[model samples]
Target: MKTTSYISRQVENLKPSGIRRFFDLAAQMDDVISLGVGEPDFVTPWNFIEQSFHALEQGYTSYTENAGMIELREEISNYLSGSFQLDYDPNEQLVVTVGASQAIDLALRTVVEPGDEVIVVEPSFVAYVPIVSLAGGTPVTIQTKAEDDFKLKPEQVKEAITPKTKAIMLCNPNNPTGTFLNKEELQQLAKVIEKNDLLVLSDEIYAELTYDDNYTSFPSIEKMKERTILISGFSKAFAMTGWRLGYAAGPADIIAAMVKIHQYTMMCAPTMAQHAALEAMKNGRQSVQEMTESYKQRRNFIVSSLNEIGLSCPNPGGAFYAFPSIKETGLSSAEFAEQLLQEEQVAVVPGEVFGSGGEGYVRCSYATSIKQLDEAMERMKRFVEKRL
Candidate 1:
């Protein structure tokens, strides 16, 4: 008997994430120093972890509401309001998710229909394109320029619009580039979104880690709030990536649709994680501040060190990653990463994994300790001198 080939067309056509490929290679090598993954190197605050155990001791391990525990939603609502001055009714406009990853997936699934176009700014987190495609939307990438610090320009957004365009995905305080969208920048893009009446999915996982001015939220734009789905989580800011807890806030109709999808897809986010996140939100500002400061120091160190070695990397204004141009080395981003890993045992991500705008650069995350960073810098210096 012969077995028939079986797989969904969507699953068959999907490409694995480029970042994951490099991570797998790095993981198998001994003495390799990785500055690849975007997660914070800090541990979750003691208070939050203790609260999770306390909840378990109290037998609060059952399933939560599909949206999440009401108390957690309330805490998130208050946190957003107090922190970003964005108003969201917890009861009507929020749904807890496994992570910002799941929230992004659910938001696209809820809003995009087959063949609809979803505009993604390039040099973004790798998850957006596949997630949009899995949700049956076409992923249309809009390349942002380094001269603009990788910020999305209004003209670019306007040019990407089409009758079939259903939504625009904004990754402010962006991952690979560490570029942030300010109020003025957001307002300019908002005008195009409002004019086209398109939906916005704002992934703000690194909002609290900004080094420059205060981070702006999409909901803060009065015109765009009604159609925007704001996705954030405790992962990056609270160092709770393993906890898999996040939430989305938006208009009632949008949130309701996402909740329905969440109900069928995941039922609910982890109960203990939700409980722990509530505690974090109520009392984790200081932990966030400490981590942000540490990242700032690392950021300054790495940017300066890279420049000293003849690689020009602009000072990142937000997030913990620094994207440095590798043009002088005469290698593509992938070749440079591979050669550095083999020669110096230092691992960094190739920027092209993030999309077209990242070709001549590589992403170096500053989330590691100063000791590790110093060592990595030395290795990087040797590698650059040898190559250049």
Candidate 2:
């Protein structure tokens, strides 16, 4: 008897995350120095962790409200108002999610109809395209140029719009490239969006990590708030990735739809995480400042070292990555990264993983310690010297 083909076409067609391939490869090699991961290397703040443990010890492990614990939601509302001058009625406009990843997934699932177009900026986090695709939307990639420091220009956004365009996915202080979209730049896109009547899926998970400029929120622009779904989490800023706590704020109707999806799909975010996040909202600012300062130092060191080694890296204004052009090395980004990992035992992500505009570049994360960064830089220097 012949066996049936079990895999769904969607699952078969989906590309595995390019970022994970290098991680799997590096795991087998001894002495591999990985600058490939985008996560903060810092441990979660002690007070936050302790709070979480205390909650669990007190048997506060039941499921939370579908919208999350009321106290946590209130804290999130206040935090957003204080940080970005954006306000949302937490009781009506918020849904607690498993992570920012889940928040993005829920947003797309909530709004996108089949064959809808979702505009994603290229050289972005790898998940955006796949998430849109899985939600039955076509992922329309808009390539942002390195010469513009990878900012998504208004003209490009305008050209990508179509009647089928359901939403625009904006990742400010973007991953891989670390390019930030300030208020002035965001206003341009906001005008186009307003004109087109398109929805905005604004992923501001890295909003608090900006180095040189005040980070801007998409919903803060006049007339854009009602049309925007803001997704953020305690992960990056408060070192709470493992807590799996994130929230989305938007128009009540949209958030209500997302809450339904979240209720059925996840039931709720972990209850202990929700309580700990409330504590973090009250006390995590000092820890955030300390971690940000460390990342700033590492960012400075890696950018300078890469430039000194003949890689043309623009100093990123935010996030913990430095994207450097590797054209002078006479190798494609993938080949360069592979050869470097094999020869120098250093691992960095090739820019192509981030999509089309990312070719001929590599993304190095500075979330690790200075000592590790110093060693990685020396390894990179030796590798480039031989090639150049």
Per-candidate clashes come to 0, 0
lDDT for 284 in candidate 2 is 90
Those runs of model 1 whose alpha carbons end farther than 4 Å from true positions after fitting are 1-4
Find the 10 residues in a row with the least total lDDT in model 1: 1-10
Q: What are the candidates' C-alpha RMSDs?
A: 1.1, 1.1
Q: Please give the range of 10 consecutive residues that has the lowest summed lDDT in model 2.
A: 1-10
Candidate 1, residue 328: Cα displacement in angstroms equals: 0.5
Residue 292 alpha-carbon offset, candidate 1, angstroms? 0.7
32-102, model 1: which lDDT tens digit per residue?
88898689899899999999999999999899999999999999999999999989999999999999999
Residue-wise lDDT of candidate 2 within 1-388, one digit each (tens)? 5444677789779999887897788888999888987789988888888898999999998988898998889989999999999999989998888989999999999999898999999989999999999999999999999888999998999999888998999998899899988889999889999999999999999899998888889999999999999999988888888888888999999999999998888899989888889889999999999999989888989999999999999989888899999999999999999999999999999999999899999999998989999999999999999989
